[model samples]
Target chain A: MVHRISLVGETFVFQDLKHILASASLLRSGDELAGIAARDPVERVAAREVLANLPLRHFLTEAIVPYETDEVTRLIMDSHDEAAFTPISHMTVGQFRDWLLSYAADTSSLEKLSPGLTPEMVAAVSKLMRNQDLVSVGRKMRVVSAFRNTQGLPARLGSRLQPNHPTDDPDGISAALLDGLLLGAGDAVLGINPASDHIGRGMDILWRFDDIRQRFDMPVQSCLLTHVTNTITMIEKGAPVDLVFQSIAGSEQANSGFGISLGILSEAWQAARELNRGTVGTNVMYFETGQGSALSSGTHHGVDQQTMEVRAYAVARVYSPLLVNTVVGFIGPEYLYDGKQIIRAGLEDHFCGKLLGLPMGCDVCYTNHAETDQDDMDTLMMLLTAAGVNFLIAVPGGDDVMLSYQSLSYHDILTLRSVFGVRPAPEFEAWLERMALVDGTRLRMNQPYALPNFRAGS
Target chain B: MSQLAQDPWGPLRRYTHARIGLPRTGDSIAGSEVRALQAAHACARRAVHACLDPAKLAVGDSFIEVRSQAKDRSEFVRRPDLGRRLDGPSIALLKQIAPAGPWDVVLVAADGLSAVAVERQAPPLQNAVRAALAHTWRIAPLVVAHNARVALGDEIGALLGVRCVVMMIGERPGLSVSDSLSLYMTWNPHVGRQDSERNCISNIHARGLSTGEGCHKLCWLLKSARKLGYTGVALKDESTNMTLLPETKTP
Candidate 1:
């Protein structure tokens, strides 16, 4: 029998034996799609059809802003009054949409059109906004973001460097490359990021501490700082700060390596030790996106890059010594995730950069979004854990972040009980209980509560 | 002799025999090793101590000796614990140097994990503290602690009866670098007390927290803590009163 078939670049007319040859050629050249050129109309038509179906905006959007609004909603619902209406009524949909589109793509306005943004969505939006502002400040401050990851395994190390290493033991080479990198810039660098927002639902978890800060007149420099301080206060006042960071994304920062905030924290810790002759508590923490707003022209708004960098550097230097754990990074609002997958990817991007080396450094991916996907939270945890990120955070709502966090805490205990035949579920349960209290609210260590009244004046 | 055995950069066995099993040095080797160790120790020590003084210090100030025994009451090199627990003579000296109690703030600089870090970082930290204190308008006593941690500031604050306490201590020796310093602050100074009750400033070394920036930050933290009436993890420093100055302006 004779057969005639056309591929992207050429047409082949073959007898029975040649048909076998064509099949083999197709199998060998499958990945050459990118390099292939359509020579005939049918091939061109087939290629165009295939290419048209491919999602391009999806890829870019996924990379830039990886958050799910529905997930954020679930988290808010889980931890806070789900029926609570957000103050979206204060701003017109156009205003909100304009504000969102200022940093994000046109599709980012999807949730704004929904009109009635759940408290969860509001929280998620608020958090994403705060992170955007914080990153702006960091850029302005010229604060060099430093990081280390907790992947400890060889493969991740290889992926960081010599990504195309053909050897089976490429990760070992990656580690060596990292070692060399640190050896050169050792003294100049700080610690890694420990995303401590994983403790309970972030905003829901944070509300208790925020309320306390209001009651105690605590300044609102950084939400992480507030949480740390509140946690410490609770410990001092006979509540365990340990519960504040239990399960979820809490351990990512506290576990070991310095994340964005944790790196600065290590610096602060050193400063505290040197100036105050003190030691941080046993429960270490890493917070992300603190001190979002600052005074510019006598108005409170998000900080610019230089101001944020200066402040971040100042905080890093001042607080280095007291670091029980280090935190680092500044994710912008463009990467905000209210009910999308972009939030997780954005967090991963930061995690990949900030948590390049260190024992505890993990993707304790943090976002200020009130609403998020519970599934995404789990997916982030799973993805990050698989990618060497074990910690994550989300406010309690219908959003996935909160759902994932709450679920992960129980999941952790359940996994431990099932795999290791141990029952640490009480610890997770206790953590949830403590998170429900005002005094025991702070999520991370070495961070303080930021009250509404407090403002970064400079 | 066999050629492989005699070869200098031969296979694994020969190299191991030539290097690992061999004791190549005598007094000179020992001297070199000691020199290297001392050099490392001095690097950390000087970085920390330099934080204390900005001026081109005289030879005597920089020349610290790690002696086997104490030379005088001021000698902290010989006794690490003595640095931790003030000697009777040292305590007497502190009493004479310090002002009357019940101050608004107290600053202490201690040689914690690495004395080298303390020597190098202290001067700049002190200078920064002075500047920050000036702006905040508070009474402070800058004390040099031989051995201490972040909480030691609270201890001194309690003894001195100050409103708040700020302490600067050495950071743990990291593999990447040594000689890093840290700062801690508290609303009330108490021994073995609250962890979150205090705030911190850290990495006050050339490589970590630079002195000029560290000092300004310290002042900001202290001022904020004082204004807020609390510090540690819960304290928030949202005050934007800080003014940036050129390097030449700071003296």
Candidate 2:
């Protein structure tokens, strides 16, 4: 059976759960819903009624731990006063504590009845220890979502790196030159590791802040922020902007020693929230692709490994959960689609299965130049959409220009008008006056129109 | 100084010249010197074509022949797609030779640049393929392409939709010899792919990596990739020294 446990409440249950809870009489340390609900008589009466009607063990097994199995049957039979175990019997703050205390004392019984109790129970209880942390994360995701929406408008009002020779110029996003093809997409633009030893390079770039301000008209605060050892603290200060560019290749090398570390996401999300409180518009960009770049052909590069595709998939699987965090929207080094059957298979398994529950409005970035065409773009979009990518750094004018560039296709615009009660962008009176419709509904391209900055985040 | 330093491919430009083993034309140089370049080029092309054509070649869209002419005639473009498809006759030939659909993996070799390398390496590669297939593995339809590169295997794999693909391609002919082979592998078929996705087994030749040793390594890689689902960047073959393979003799 697949074991799915939250990381939140694990530690307390494993280490000193019974000891800590007994000493700390206060069940709700700081204003959890259980504490408030306990004080309300009306809610308590309703809960008692439901509990009395419902089978207590059934609810506990389904909600608390699905694999209680034989433990539930054994626990009920062992209890001498089986009538006391009725659902209507209210578990008061004290009674709940006593019951837990009794449960902990019967560890020997638990072990005897359930042979799989020792390590597995420890792991399950350990997972529940992170519940305190989960509450904070849930609240933070909600707040960051609101903040991301609020910062959306004011930030889009200005320009970014200049368009012409945009890739050449480090800061050419604002004054875009020809079209959306300037830097290709966000991932391709920011995913490059041009400077080796990023922390030192970041310091070098930070030192040149005065020169950068003089050279470009960007805001004084619009500096690039990278995740160094002290990145979270740096984000709080609101000086250098943040860019999360961890090397997938480097991480793949680490997989041998460190079996999948999921704590990195919580740490990054916590850090982003801390920084968001101080800074209004976000200057953070995420990049975690290009895991296969480090594989050498024939020559051993010190790492004992099998093939490149394995490393890429390993890296993706490790980082999949972290993608759900609100701070991260950009992802790339999207070289997995390269016509290698093995690598593609791994990508399908890991990416398709593991990556769900992505934060709404997340964008996928492709870092390196795959020279991807329309068909490639379509496949990538379908894959990302399935993986829950709402926003993407699409190839401008590459696929259907209407969907990619204008964010509206003929069918979509018509559907919006008829079904959703929304009109097309060109349907505005001023826009209609300026634009000409050729084929009844579709607007024919006559004069060139500059792309309105559709960057979602601040 | 930085531009000079960054030019990794600079030293290779001088490596380009007419190959050896052709009849004396005495066009550019006197006697033996003129004949040497011609011979080398002829030998290289012959070797490449010999391995590629006989063992089934597929370009982009379909399978091809050792010495087939394009009906469209404009197919000699530098781009990937133009030279991918094979003519009807070559496709018919491939259909006869190619195994049925949904193979676990396929092995393909291409002339790429030097046919001499293909000729020299084909026997060892065949030996390796036999050794791998001896395990009763479900093998895919292997095909050859005319002009190719390392990631060209990715393109072929993508087009074919095989489970795994390993393409043995000709390395650029060097002064020492023209018959050097490189092996590239991927999990699923991907065409028009890049370097950062797949793994490679390169310099598999009599001089560098013995064909037997290359075969052993490829087998090991194929097994691991199948088990783990992907390979290339994460595979570290630091176990036994490849140079110490019992069958290998230094050229």
For every model in order, what is the iRMS? Answer: 27.5, 24.1
lDDT tens per residue, model 1, A1-458:
44455556666543332122112211111111112223344543433233222222221122111125222212222333212224233443224423443544222233222223322122223222333432231111111111121212221111110101112122222222122111111111112112343333333323433343235332111122334433444334433121222111211222122222443344433332233211212213333322111211111112121122122222222221111111211221212213232333333233222211112222222222112323444444333333332223211111111111111221221222233232211222233233331223211211111112211110
Q: Name model 1 segments beyond 4 Å from true.
A: A1-458, B1-102, B135-138, B237-243, B248-251
The worst-scoring run of ten residues by lDDT in candidate 2 chain A lies at: A400-409
Worst 10 residues of 2 chain B by lDDT: B18-27
Give the TM-score of each candidate: 0.30, 0.30
Query: Rounded to one decimal, what is candidate 2's iRMSD?
Result: 24.1
Q: How much is the lDDT of residue B191 in candidate 2? A: 52
Model 1 DockQ class: incorrect
Note the clash tally of each candidate.
200, 79
Residue A270, candidate 2: alpha-carbon lDDT: 52
The list of candidate 2 runs beyond 4 A from truth reads A1-198, A202-278, A281-358, A361-390, A394-458, B1-251
Please estimate how well model 2 matches the true structure, expressed as its whole-model Cα lDDT.
0.35
